[model samples]
Target: MFKRLLLTLAFSSSIIWFGSCAQKSQTTADQIEKAKEQHAAVVEQTQQQQKLLEEKTRKLQEENQQLQAQLQRLQEEKRELEKQKAQIAKIQKFQNVKAENLQSAQCEINPDLGVPLNPPQAKPGECFAIGYLPAKYKYEKVKVLVDAGGEKVITTPPKYKVVPKKILVREESKKIVVIPPVYKTVTEKVLVRPATTKKVVVRPAKYKWVTEKVLVEPAKKVWKRGRSFLTHAVATRFDPNTGDILCLVEVPPKYKYIKKKVMVEPPVVKEVPVPPVYKTITKKVLVKPAQTKEVVIPAVYKTVYVKELVEPAKVQKIKIPPKYDYVTKRVKVRDEQFLWVKVLCKDNMTKDAIIKLQKALKSKGYYRGPIDGIYGPLTQEAVVNFQKDNDIPITPGAVTLKTLQLLGIK
Candidate 1:
């Protein structure tokens, strides 16, 4: 519908413009024809009248120039109007594309209700537009099953009482016992010592002195700053004095040989064996051999009791109840959407409203034009861009209610 309206208005404007242009062109032609006839008539008069005719002719030419300028301006204005239409068409196409995409968008879901969140339709006097609807939540305490019912097993141990009873452990028998041998002490004389050979060195060790060189210092290259011998001034390696130079020189280490004593030959020794030594000592001598004896033995007994099963294990069924609990869950109550909204246009727009709109857009970094209370091209461009960025209905050159609400304006 809007596109058709635009086309109709454009056609009407073109017809009117062309008609006005044709009328003006005809009038100018007629005026030029009349002026030519008057020039001919003036040429037939005196020379003085001819001067007046020339002046009039020049004036008429000036008027023609002015008319031509006006026509050029009209043409330029028509071009501008066409450009504006193109821009409007582009914006409309963009909006149509966006609407197509939005059609496929799924509605927001309410978690708690398990349904899509849909707001009530706008009333006649109210404006509805898409807006962020935060999720609502509530805390609740609910019962939840923690454990299920099951069977349990229980057992009782058997009873027991202790009583004494005699039992033979060993049988009676006659046994023979052995006695240890006895011994008598006696003194005897024996050899106390024998001859032994000792290890004897055949030759003594020999020693000699040898000379060896030991390193006293290592060789290295060192940097040395140049010094002024006359003034005894040594220049620093860094930030040196003028004409001073540093040199890296190699210095050889000095060493000296030293004499040390060392063994030249090892000593030799010989070993010799000798007879074993003996000594006189007092010792015991056996006087009797081992003997045995017989004796009577008694049997052994112990007390014990037998075990028996008294009761068997059994299972018990227990009915465990279910536990329950409640938790807070967020659920959407309403979702944002697009609807008919009142906007600031020529009908309701005012200087104050425009100024406020410009100020708001400026604050949101969308506008850079002066806040002169005029919805000029720059202001309109700002509004259209803002609407596009914010997903508001793209009302080019107009400020919608949703735009104002988002900008924090009442």
Candidate 2:
């Protein structure tokens, strides 16, 4: 009985140990499942956090790119501004140089005069002693130095002057006697024959016969029957209607010679005429006698006288005086003078003033350079050109007030 009890106690101890071990294993399994659930929740939270961070990073990169683009645009604008500034500066420098040149040109001195002088003036109706004339004389009372030598009168003796005496003297006066011309008509025979012509005969035309050869028949093509032998015995036949055979033979064309008569040419004859003519005329002869009549004449005589010069005339030399008168005159002492006047010079010129000048020049089609406020060489040249075209005098390199006014610039 004691031995049986000890065996029961050992069996109970073994049962309790197995029960404890089973309980410990169940607890371990439950803890493992809970740990797996917690791990899955932590992984999900980490993935969400990572996605948010990536989105933030993407936005930052976009912002950075935008900032960079803005920076580049600003940089380009800055470069353009710098280029424009450089251009403006260059133009201004050129304008300044041109202004200096103009000033120098205006200050040039005249070659003839050591110093500037005012021009001479002239007044109308001004008199001046031109020259003098020699003393003049007039025709004073002209007196005869010595009476012309007296002329002596020659007196003729008192002899009887033979006067013209016409005496009726008896003289035979001759008279022309006229006799009528006598013409005797003589009869004479002259031949006046008419022209005559004779006719001629012409022979008839004649012709000769000529012999020639002519063709009787023309060349033609003809077909004839022929035979052909073949290695194999074949039937040979002739086409009665078409005259066609295995081989055709050519027939020669036939022709005949013919004679013909032709006329070559004919001969001709002509006739001519001969003529004769004659004429007759008549004439007359003349015979005559003439006589004269008698007339009377008379005698004639004439008388003459002698002459002598009485008182004679004479000539003498005389003097005359020249006329004189007073008149007004005008004279020029000097030419007009050009005086230097104050103007807009380089020292006093400003960008604004230069711009105004440039604009004015441009309006007149003088300044083609840039309108930037800089007064460059081009601007100076424009001013010069403007002055020259307008007939305005250029004063060295100065922008004279006159020039400004002409250009419509203040």
Candidate 3:
């Protein structure tokens, strides 16, 4: 029974020792697992903090790009404003000058000429009447009424022309950002907050945009010439694009589309033309009207005699003239028809035949008026006088063959 008790106690002690060892091992393993879990948590937290820092830096870079773009735009606007100001100053300088000083030459008056007419011859020792001369000379001294009076100066209506006004016009189309420049913008998002300790953080912002304007002077486009004519071509048409405004730009404005400049040369027609410029411009313009006013010249029908020289009343203008081929004259030849006297001239000759007859008669010394070779009344009379004087009498008429033979002409 003592041995049985000893065996039971030994078994119990072994069980207790084994159980204690198992408990100690299990506690050590649990402690190690807990340490591993804490280490993993620390690593995960460090990685998260690093990621947050990277995101913050990326946001900062975006904000910096946006600030740079804004700065560029402001600089561009400053330049444009300065240029515009310079142009305005130049225009002001031009305005100071007057329109009169810009003008050049002048038109003058030409004295009216007085033509001389024949006067009655003056008798000797008679009161020689004052006669008007052609051109008058300015006398330095006034003498007594001289024998010759001179022309008096008179004012004549001056010729005038029209001058048109030319004006420059400006047109503006509102600027539409057809192809607007795209750039980055910054937006902040709260991702994480410090867990260990809270500290106040203040940071200096980067790239603060300050707008500035620098003058970009417009190119001096000198208007070369302008037209001023009576028959004028005044055109007001436009497909024009004016100068840009003072706008700041990070990127240059792009052209989505453009309307090209079109030059239109006006059509010309048949009209009284005028010069482009004139020496002097007069406001008292006596325009010669297209239709005229008929002044009532007093119907002075006092004592007009119907003299030999009759002033022909103007008849409606005959638009056409009578075409003349030839004419046949009637003759009173009482003698027989003289069937054998039928004659045809190569070319009809009235003047030449008369001249031949006269020349033949002169050779025979029976003619005296003229060898003018004309078939006028003088020649006809001479021929008749010759026939009567030669005793070959015939009524007054144009010459014939027998009469020609008698005048020694073939």
Candidate 4:
């Protein structure tokens, strides 16, 4: 029995110890499961944090790209501004500048990346747009002249737009040498039209006057010879002379006048073609003169002939075609004399004296145009004609000192 109890106790002790160890092992397992859950939670949290950091990095990269683009645009704008600065100074001198015209503002190139540090602006502080305001410039000057004697006038300037205006024009004149007046002859062809002329004439017409002789049956009349058994002699008298001519040899005026016949011709009638006739009926209307006043507009031309400077300059080979000169009109512009006059042409003789020359003979209706210090046909003819008609020496075309006295020229 004692042996049995010991064995039983040992078994019981073994059971207690085993039960305790089993409880301890279960606790340890629980601790291990908790630790594993903790480790898993840490790993998950680390992955979530890493994902967030990667998103932030990607956003930062996008922002950096935007910034780089903005920097590039800014650099371009700066270059443009510097280029236009010089031209702006020159233009400023001609036009007034407003305070607002120079307003500057920074432009933000990208809006999606973040709130713009600077906004895109037309009137930016950094630069001006050459497209809106021209970088290159040009200058011109105009003259405003006032009359020395005139009403004092106030002037108000007008504003101008950028549209180009045509250049002003002016004209210049110069004196030129020309020939003088002289009588000349020319041949011309003439055409003549026949004119109608009317005339009338009277002529004798065919007619007859007859006188009849009386036969023996004639009535008796007392005669110097008394009644004769035969016929009495008929007498005819001449119209101017009353002398009678015996006409038994040819029966005389005692005979009776017989019927006379005359032949007639029909009057000539000709048909004529007449021109169309027009008639005028008066009506009230405004009448204009045959000639109208002419407005003499002065000739206009340019003075400045500026040539453009071209890039990659090239010389243009302009082939000018040959041209011809034309004479628009022939006018007596000048008349002069440089020779001595004949003595008999005017008065006393001299060696070197200016006679009644064309250029200087205005008092006697001679001379034409400027005296260009020469003698020509027009001057010589005037002197010759004056001498010939005035009963002076009729020298052909020579001027001697003697002719100078009468002309009052020395």
Candidate 5:
């Protein structure tokens, strides 16, 4: 009995173990299925995320390409702007050079007439010796000198006279006569005519009646259904199996005939002539032509005293001495001569020097004008007076070296 009891207990334990193992196996399988399902769901979600990323990347790439194109265009524009700037700069440089050249060319210096040093200096033709310099120079030279001097004497001859003698004259008188014109009565005949006008007539224009025809409705295409003669069946129009007809029908337009007047010929004009009227009238006519008669005239004469030249006009020679005087004259020994000498000219002259000159003149009571820096007429006159008073050689209207030295201006 105990062995049987043991066997039963072992069998019961074995069955319980088997059942637990089956249950655990089933739980593990369920967990594994749930894990597989979750993994598949995550993988599908990852795939969707990757697709979205790819689409975003594609859009970004397209935007980047467009931006790059814009950048390239901007770069090209920048290059064009730089080129234009360079060209403008080059043009400005050329203009500057041209302006400078024009300024220089316009300010050309004259070589013959040097700039004036002082206002009072004698110009080229005034005095025996005049001072001037080469153009734009600081030195003086005598440019003129008289070549000759002379005096002339004149004489006049005595006057001549003519005399006339009187002779006997006679006077005469004569009787005069005149003729008068004569006229006679006369008669004349003249015709008087009057102007006449002719009558003119214009005929009315002629016309004719005509008729014309016009269309009111145009031709049209229509569809009609009919029974086929071969099949004896009615069908839709334009069907091939069914007997149908497509017909083009022209509907005549309704028109009415009416009479219309149209001018066939223009009007005609006729003119009738009328004879001119005339009338006769009486007038004065010349019978004998007018004549002029001459009257006798008597002549008178008278005698008068008259003067006549016995001798013809003749010139009498009278000896006249020439008028003479001991006149002093300055004669130039040499022609115009030039010699270079250190001098102050306009190019090197300063306002200070001019002021000093004016002051000096004023101090010596030679100048009565303002002490302006300009060497004007007043200063020139002062210089001349000073030179004259100091017994300095006077170069007419010129500021000479001797003059300057005497004034202590050198």
Candidate 6:
């Protein structure tokens, strides 16, 4: 009864240990699956973000192209405006200077320098500069007969020519002559793209996984006991080397198989010859020479003059009258004026805004310094020049809104 109980106890202990081991293995598998799920989610999110970035970049490029086109049109308009402003300035240049040695009867306004005479009537939120109204003219063509028809007399002159006779030379003469060369077309080859030898892997280095046995534990000798079959007694020996029944015991070497790679062939390089290309061409060659031939002569005549009526004798009417044309004359319509204008100054701008402003000015060929996002002397000067060139209100040390509009920045 006790032996049976001992076997039952040993079996129960083994079952409990095996159940715990299986639960641990199941937990490890679940962790591995969870890790795989997390990795996949991360990969998907990365791809989505990349796509978003690409879309944004494409949209930015399209916007940039549109801005460039708009800038081009603005620059063209600015140039035209600059031309008109220059003409106006030229015409109105005398407004700022007073006349010298003038009598009171010749002048209608006072010569005082404090206020300008006949200034332009400016409206609210509007600016004005000194500009002259160019002269206007109306053209008229007068129809006055320059030439009147009258009778005319014509006369014919006489003509004459001289004649000559040719005498016959010796009999017929023979002369040697050379003939031009002839040509025939032929086909030939020409190398357009040169022939070159290149390295190629004719037989690449090959490898294969081969199973090989490796020794883990080597063979070793150990002492063992010998038992008597009749008495069933344990044999006790003092010296392991000296025993009553000498037995040889050995543990065979343990071996294991593992996959390994073995090279089958090595890489190779070979030189190969390439054939040259050909093309057909036409050429000239000497085919025949000049031969002697007979010649013939003919009579020649001299020039002569003959009396002929080249033009009929008739009367044509002719008359002379007055000539007339229309001429243009300038007539002043309005006087130059001066007024105040609005502009951008240091109070309403930041570094980022300045950077964008600088870029716009640079693209329009107004600014030449680096885009350092600084409202420095270079930027201010560029703004003034741009404003002047585009016919915007040129307030010193400030940029007019009209200038920004012309630069396509607004």
Best by TM-score: 2
Stretches of model 3 off by over 4 angstroms after superposition: 1-11, 100-410
Model 3's lDDT to the true fold?
0.40
lDDT string for model 2 (1-410, tens) is: 99667545655664575457546644643454455546557657866786787688658855765665556556655765675576446434434444344344424545352324321242343211101111122223322222122332322222222223344434544442222234566766544333545544354445555555555555543434455453232345678787656433333455555455444544344434444433232344566532122323223222222223333433333332322222222222333224444466454578888889888889889989999987666876787677656655444355767788887776
Write model 1 residue lDDT over 197-232, tens digit each, in one string. 767789888899999898888887665665434233
Q: For every candidate structure, what is the RMSD over all alpha carbons to the true structure, in angstroms?
A: 58.4, 74.0, 55.5, 68.5, 63.1, 43.3
TM-score of each: 0.24, 0.26, 0.23, 0.23, 0.23, 0.24
Q: What would the TM-score be for candidate 5 when compared with the true structure? A: 0.23
Segments in model 2 whose C-alpha atoms lie over 4 Å from true places: 2-7, 98-410
Runs with alpha carbons beyond 4 Å of true place in candidate 5: 97-410
Against the reference, the lDDT scores of all candidates come to 0.57, 0.49, 0.40, 0.40, 0.48, 0.52
For candidate 3, lDDT tens digit of each residue in 1-410?
Answer: 99667555655664576468557644654454456556557657866786787688658855765665556556655765675576445434433433222111012111221211211353433221111111111213212221122232222222222222333333433432122222334443322222333233343223333344433443232221233221232332222364322222123233333344333433333344332321221122233322212323222221211213223323232232222222122222232110111111313345777678778766766567688776555555565556445544332333444466666666
Model 1: residue 31 alpha-carbon error in angstroms: 99
Q: Which ten residues in a row are the worst by lDDT in model 4? A: 128-137
Clashes of each: 12, 21, 8, 18, 27, 20
TM-score of 3: 0.23
The positional error of residue 208 in candidate 6, measured at the CA in angstroms, is: 68
Candidate 1 lDDT score relative to the true structure: 0.57
lDDT of 3 at 157: 23
lDDT ranking of the models: 1, 6, 2, 5, 4, 3
Task: For residues 1-410, write the lDDT of model 5, one tens digit per residue.
Answer: 99667555655664576468557644654454456556557657866786787688658855765665556556655765675576446433423332223223324423343423333444653322233221111223332222122332222222222222333333343322122223343444333334555646488789888775554555443334443332323333356775455333333456655667788997676657656543343333445532223334323232222233344534444443332223222233333222223234444346788788888888888988987788776876686567546644333234566666777886
Instruction: List model 6 lDDT by residue over 1-410, tens digit each.
Output: 99667555655664575457557644654454456556557657866786787688658855765665556556645765675587557544533232221112123444342234433464555432222223232334434332232433322223222222334434553432222223454555444336776677777888888999999999865445554332333343444466465334565789999988988776787877665533343333446532223323223332222233444544444442333323232223433333233444445567777888999989888889999998777886687677555545443334556666777766
Best by lDDT: 1
